[model samples]
Target chain A: MAYTAEKPVPPPSSDELRARIPGWGADLDPADRPSFPRESLDLRPEGAHWDFPERQEPDGPRERSVEHKFLTPVFGTAQPLTGISGVIRRYAYDRFSEGRAAHWLLLIAGDRVDAIESHLKSFATFRPDNPITETGLMAEVKRHPIRSRFGRGRADLRHTWIDPILVAGPWVLTGWLVLKVLRPKR
Target chain B: MRAMTYRGPYKVRVEEKDMPKIEHPNDAIVRVDLASICGSDLHLYHGLMTDLRIGHTFGHEFIGTVHEVGPSVQNLKVGDRVMVPFNIYCGSCFFCARGLYSNCHNVNANATAVGGIYGYSHTTGGYDGGQAEFVRVPFADVGPTIIPEWMDPEDALMLTDAFSTGYFGAQIGDIHEGDTVVVFGAGPVGLAAARSSWLMGAGRVIVIDHLDYRLEKAREFAFAETYNFNEYDDIVVHMKKITGFLGADVAIEAVGAEADGNLLQHITAAKLKMQGGSPVALNWAIDSVRKGATVSVIGAYGPIFNAVKFGDAVNKGLTLRMNQAPVKRQWPRLFEHIKNGYIKPSDMITHRIPLEHIAEGYHMFSSKLDDCIKTVVVPNAS
Candidate 1:
């Protein structure tokens, strides 16, 4: 949500996070960190002539984390925030530090939302998503279906039974819904 | 000019961008001829990387024709077809002096771990990538080599990252002749690693993945035995049983960040982002290898807490070696291998997408749609 050049508001205090979340800052102790000895900030001389590199101007609003003082000098502009997914992603960046699991979980939820959005958008086009070819169902059938799964010491064999339902369940439901709608008032 | 720009997680588009100009004495402006989407780019696409700026181009593996060169550049001239290494390093830095171009000290100001990588994000030095009509290449004299006249441009593009990295993965394993090597992941880098393991005298090579198509590729391309980990109860135990309970002599982890295996680990790392990346492949590598065996990690992970099985590694007395591959350091041997018909790096490419359609290319690759193994972008294609 923050696209300003100014510094962002500070994140919640560590004390507050620790009070709210279980197992917060478990690795805060240097003794627990194996990499603590090598994590020294020696700040050796990096031979750049400029104090700050020239920033690539942002063409539109860019996402900024609450933990960061400001956006980096350069930022990407390929994809901008849109739909409900954008709002969720913005909330993740705004409320949680990168350390918090909530930040990432929310983002993952946003990705799922985005996928649904893409599926909806695909229907508007001439070619909607074809779950059959796209999902490699033909390849599964042609390429040693039973033989590969039966004797093979595959770890995913436990869940292979549900994969078809997981992959095709949505499409099947959607197709049935369409069929009902086109049933000519029967 | 036009380039691929990052919009947000799982979103990208082609947009008009400023033409790159030489900014340094050692810089060169390359008119991109071909750029490929790397498997590592999926980390950024999935929004797993930190400080990823919107609108930044996302490409690292590329080859192009030199359009302009800085005043100090001596090795290349305008119009020379060149293949640039992904690492943007100053040739004389402490690490670069030791041929550790990937860990060059002078390029990236954000962190001390990895050197500058084009289009990788500000963390790797905010250099624009070549998934565009033009890109500015820094340290031009040192990083970009003239593409061999006899080498196919497609082959040269593979040398930029995937092939070189795979070769480096095998090299660092310190593989003794006739050693059993198990590679986890069948991406281009994994395939290259499996193939290169033979060159290093590996007696038997095994490639593991859940995807049948990619596993098929591993067998056909790398000439190695392939297995689907999803079919096994415990892949690590299977490794033990197969190797006479001694386990593999060497294991290479090519799957990083969003590795899928353990549901809890995937949720914590990939979904919850509590850890930097899922350590499933890495844990499997460590557990599958024999005690005191060498494990090579070429997979990319964020600089944060990963739930890696370090205790197991220490207890087993395993030697773990990993780094960003020093692309140029392994080139001479790779060039010979390519010229000798021993390896064809271009064989991995499955799709040739135009720059304008790079967003679709990214989505397809990210989704694992169309059985895509590798995609190369043709900028300014007719």
Candidate 2:
């Protein structure tokens, strides 16, 4: 017989996986079975769709990045505009700055790509309690804030916070495009 | 430098070759003192493995003196005597972290089929092996270890692959005290497995082989019972009758793709390279072992499909465990065992030849001439 990419046996269904789960060990607890979730047990055909594109038009290719602008400070101090608009704008600026720092952290430490990809995969799974999901390694990479050895650490009001409106708006618009415009037929 | 180069199937010659140099920060250049022609090398010798480029050297089990060391090599130093494991693994990979060193994801460019192996074939990452005057070892700090001052170089050479792989084959069987074990094949690895079965507290170890010389070695080395399968009408039935119809508690398939049960399986799998070496031994393991028994396979097979009895294994509820033996992991215990004199691995070495005469050594070994149980090539001899 010639080599075949396909497995000889048909993949087991969720029920079959459940039945076969106990065979790994006689005293394996039923509670332990939940760790290996039904979705994980489904052995989708090998190379069933290897030729398929990484993403379709609906998903628009799983993106690790998006374009955003860093806002320069117009004045060297916080604007004295006293309104609800000022408070909301400041909050958005804080959030965007933190996200930008994380992107810089990822960029500086290219070795942590696998860890970041693992984090992205976990976020993709959306299972909050999947213990196998690694969050510590990701946090460990992000924990030590990026520090410039030279005078690169000097604070500059000109490049302080990313353009909050421009940076945050694209992300929000991308989410809307995905949910409303690009949602494929179920 | 002189090295044994493969010209074609059953054709090998010792030719002048360039001395290897440190290519990576983690690399070390070792001046090979002693190298053994592993049984798995025969897969390439017989032209069973694919992508075996001409002039490729073939030897994985070797012990030598460190000639040079790269900057990242932390454990070894120049002039240190060392034995290198067959696996070329990056220490920090996820698989390496879990002690599954054989499946290390970082070392091999083609990590899906198999991990990096020294001088087997292109299917196994295509790294040159140690069957030469000097070899460049990658990930030197992780895979190669200094041989203890008291240990013999010949013994250390065996530890690099054959003995460790055999012990790993038996370890995966999960053999409990008093378990009846049956090992198929009586080659060097098979001999090692049978011998290791004793170490694992097997009540009775039975080795099956067609060759009387190997069976004789199995009996002497392992102190196990031996059976010539050629003499039996139905080997499985014979096994069943001997084990009170419950069959052996554990079965090990040590014979890989080129198992010789009959003419067609031998012709198709071995000669024609159609199916991954015949599954005759594996089928025998599945049929001969009792239901729910564990089956351990350490045979070297190509990274392709085989005509295995998967349904029989599933229906019998057998636990099939297999992997390329993570050779380095077996070292600590093996070291202690060798220290305690529980096993003397060098006892299996039956012939020793100079590097220049390695072609004749290969021919003698492949032809089973002079009762060649194991052959060691001394590279330094003029």
Candidate 3:
């Protein structure tokens, strides 16, 4: 039989679409591109007209009524590995002791990461279409990533792990020396 | 006027009935020149559609000359030969607007949500059948097709519904550019589904059915590869073998109750991986599609609703589409495709009989006794 290639052909660019069904004005700008309704365009209806079974709606983040000394609270988007929005949302239940009294466990990782490594799936309450806006407990989840990493009173996460790497080896010593030599005197 | 009325189980009487008159502005009175028995019509003959009262006209598949047209009619005129799709449709509706005309709300309204079909049941909008001397057509401008002069009545008669439904089923099955599609039945709709798949550029079509006669016919046409489910205990083994071990990307379950009733019990107990099927073809579309694949089911599902396996369907990311044929909606494209050599759908017809002996034709077809594939009924009374 013939082979099925999964690669999708790129459709027209956003600029090209604007030329077709534009809003009432000319200089409506590039941001206005791709803003159209389902009925307005000849789009291929991808999903099933019928909803999938199971009807999974991931429960929202349970508020933390308790505080523990060793355990830190980690709150982030649902799944870290997949897209943030889907019918099913899964969050990693963190390791806890005694009466397990916490929901979202926020994990800090390499500062360059846009989202936590905890496998980000969308909170069931949040949808891609009608997104849970930048407010409430849901919005707080997003801001934590930006604020903790790069803001007015940001903590240097790099510094915390740097000393350990320095003590761990001869290769680390060579790296520190090379950087120190390259540094300009202030 | 002579009308073929349902007499009893497996019996119909050609008796006199008043000639139909156009009641609506969009209505057209058609003097039926040809009509045929559908596999679904057997559902009534066998008593599946039991609630039908006396004098129920027995056929829906028809093609005829328009005798009268209302003032609002624009596209058609009297004396034009036309094929009437079984499912009447309103140009507007969620189903029609999206091109799923067979499931139109206003047209097929049987006093329910999804709507009714002609000659099916009282539950299905009690529209009369075309298996009569004269029948009234609703939405005349959109309903009838002007049969091409060169085309044979045999080919034109098929466009009515069976061919269109099968074609629609094939279109919905998501055959895509180059892919292997497996069809479960080798009956009329199944064959059309196979042909439809080929037209969509399917690399190989694997058709499954028990009857050696139908299967041999399928094999002759290379209507995909054929599998005799009666011979083999496991249909899926041979099905997968043909698809290069990945299981077919698309599987068409056109055989409704023809498969097995007891198997349903075993399937429910077994795991989804071993199941390899949807109990009902129309509903279990998720079962046939490859993960993140598509399943278009045009086969008749039921007189009542049935539940679908959602857990497996969703986890696999299957896309399911069902309902009646998009006959009117696809008419223009279907006409173009047939007018060209792009699709030869009429090749499935195995029998052609005049209206007078339609009873015997129905008996041969409905009983599947003489191996009648599709019997086209022409009016000899004319």
- Per-residue lDDT for B216-278 in model 1, tens only? 999988888888887788999998877767789899999899788897787667655677799
DockQ in order: 0.03, 0.01, 0.01
lDDT of 2: 0.66
Any runs in candidate 1 off by more than 4 Å, and if so which?
A1-186
Query: Which window of ten consecutive residues has the lowest lDDT sum in model 2 chain B?
Result: B104-113
Off by over 4 Å in 2: A1-186
Cα lDDT tens digits, model 3, B1-382, are 7777654334455656777765556678888887878777765553334234434676678888889997667778998888777766555546545655555555431223334455664434456778877777766765567887867776677777776777667666655545667776677778877766665556556776656668877766434577666565455555545445455667676765323323452233111112222254433335544577666655453333234567877787776656666565455656666666555656777777666565566656643544567777666555
lDDT of each residue in A14-107, candidate 1, tens digit only: 5654453333333234333222222123312233334343444555666665555665443333345678877887787678766676765666
Error of 1 at A60 (Å): 20
| Residue B295 in candidate 1, Cα distance off native in Å | 0.6
Candidates in descending DockQ order: 1, 2, 3
**lDDT by residue for model 2 over B99-218, one digit each (tens)?**
666765555432234677888754455467778898878777778888999998899999999988898888888776557889998888888888777666666789998767778898
TM-scores for every candidate against the unseen true structure: 0.72, 0.68, 0.62
Report the TM-score of candidate 2, chain A only. Answer: 0.18
